[model samples]
Target: MLRPYREVLARPGALAFSSAGVLARLPMSMVGIAIVLAVPEVYGSYGLAGQITAVYVIVHSIAAPLLAHLVDRHGQARVMMPALRVAGLGIVGIILAIATAAHPGWVFAGAVVAGASIGSVGALVRARWSYILRDPAAIHTAYSLESALDEFVFIVGPVVATVLATSVAPTAGLWLPAAAVLLGGWMLLSQRATEPPVVRREAGASGGSSLRSGGMVVLTLVFAAVGSIFGATDVSTVAFADELGSKKAAGTVLAVFALGSMLSGLGYGLRHWQSPLWRRFAIGVVALACGVSLFFVVSSLPVLAAVMFVTGFTIAPTIVNGNGLVTSFVRPDQLTTGLAWVGTALGVGVSIGSAAAGAAVDQQGAHGGFLVVAASAAVAVVATFVALPTLRAGHAPAGRGAGPADYATVVPNSDPSA
Candidate 1:
């Protein structure tokens, strides 16, 4: 398990950028729960909290692909540095608004700014991996490692956010994400050696958007459903723990969930799959649906935690395969944009799920939110089966710039010896 990861990280600048990427992407896990905890405590309404979070996530979903396009056109440092600054300001605005008891409109405005500018650091990092590594097997291992790192982020971020929110100050939880973004963004952008070069288009050339591919569209929608499950689970678990008078324990429960995924991700990376990527993705989605359905029946915190851990087993494998399939559906030039679409779909689903679960929690408590989770999973299952034909025919159309085969250029220091 460690051998593959060691080989990948052995490439010069790989360890540096990936480490920085993890730091920068920490906000991905922290921001949702921080907002969920802070807004309700300050405003006394879970519905309002959810709405604010929805606004942020929805705008993020809209903005990430656009930012990624810019990155593809220009370069990561040039685009992401300014975007990170704007996002930092937005977070500051949110913190100030909440602290000063400013009008709700201020919060909404801040959310919009923050959401539109945060950009998908996860996509950015993965793009770096794709740029630097040439081997298909190496790429698979790298993605799996990133997924596991993502789980690690989730494990630590929520616990810190939850503790700060409940024990120190609600606003305190939001601060860490903001700080991480600044520090991590700088660290990542400063390492220019591993960044993917901008792929300029020929005059009059039109490769079009990655969304033009039917398979990509199908994958996006299915990912949206998966994202909804994530959103619903986060809000529901928080509420459930609160209801049981052990709110702090929400972090621990969520950590357990991530632990399962992280462990699985580590194992999944080591395998050499003989099956098609789409088939693996579909199976993972089905397993995820079945696992989440169990959430609807849990009556205690321990039971919920146990179910979450089991359900988590399906997440990383599903995501890694879905990302792998992106290469199958889009041109090499569209890699970043394509990956950002996956993140965008997830953000959109999370917005919907957060708002829906928030409303449901307000009406029927924690279990209501769990209902949304199960429902979202069911939607994912349906979408996956219904779109099976399209997913199986995963090649992009001809004249789409070049297929992912053209994606594997030899970047400097890509070798383990380097």
Candidate 2:
């Protein structure tokens, strides 16, 4: 399990950028919880805090793909440095507003600005991997490791943010993430050697838009559904814990969820697959649906945690492979944007899921929200089947790039000694 990752990191400059990227992304998980804690503590209104966080998420989701498109056209360094700097300034302004008890409207606007300034750091990091490896066999390992790192980030980020806000200082959580955005982003931007080549748009090219590509819309919708499962499960888990008079159990149970995904991601990356991309995605969704459906039957916290652990087994493979599928269909010039769109779709889904889960938990109890997760996975499965023909058609006329049709076709050249 460790050997493959060690070999992948042995590539020139891989460790430096991957480490820096992880640092930059740690803030991605921190900011939400930090905002939920800080805004209410300072402003005395959870409503206002909720609104600020929602605006931040929506604006960031809308902005990420556009930022990635710019990163695609220009170089990563040129785009990332300015973007991270602006984001850092925005976060600082928000912190200052909180410290001084500025008007809620000013704070809200600052949050929007900060979110709009955030580049697609995770997608860009994955793009760097795609750029460096350039082989299907190698890229699979890279994506899996990246997904595992994501689990690790979410695991540590909330704990760090909460501890700093509660035990250290109310403003400490926000401050550290702001610093991370600046320092880590700057370090990542300094790595020029491994950056993806900027492919300028051809003069007469008609089809560069990833959104318009064949099956991409469906794929995006599937990713959105996947995101909803996460959102609904999170809120529902919190509600479950609250009902049990142990609100803090929310974090521990969620850690179980992350642990399940992290373990499975490591295992998934260590093997080579023989199925076609679409077929594997189909299998993944089915597995996800079956696993999440068990949530509807579990009644106790221990049972729920066990179900969550099982449910998590499907997430990493589904997401990692979905990303790989994007490489198969998108134009080389639009790879980063295409990948960013997946993140955007997930954001939108999470918002919808969170809202729906909140309403369900309020009206029907925590168990009600479990239905949403199962439904989401089922919906993704249906979308996969319905989109089969379009996906089989593969890349549109304009954006066809270099990806094998089947995973089995990827000749394994993973020399652990490399």
TM-score against native, each model? 0.90, 0.93
Name the runs in model 1 displaced over 4 angstroms: 40-46, 239-247, 361-367, 395-418
Clashes of each: 0, 0
Q: Pick by TM-score: which candidate is best? A: 2
Q: What is the C-alpha lDDT profile of model 2 across 1-418, one tens digit per residue?
A: 4788888889998989888999999878888889888888888988788788889999999988999988777778878789999999888878888878889887787788889988778888888888788557678888888988888898899989999999877767888889999999999988888777666444455554788886678889888988888888888888888988888989989989988898888888887676677777778878887887787677778888988898788878888888888887776667899999998998888888888888898898888887787777788778888888877678332222643331112212222211
lDDT of each: 0.85, 0.81
For residues 116-208, could you state the per-residue lDDT of candidate 1 as single tens digits? 999999888888888788777788888999999999998898788888989999899999989988999999988888887766555555568
Candidate 1 Cα deviation (angstroms), residue 388 = 1.5
User: After best superposition, candidate 2 residue 342: deviation in angstroms?
Assistant: 0.3
Clashing pairs in 1: none
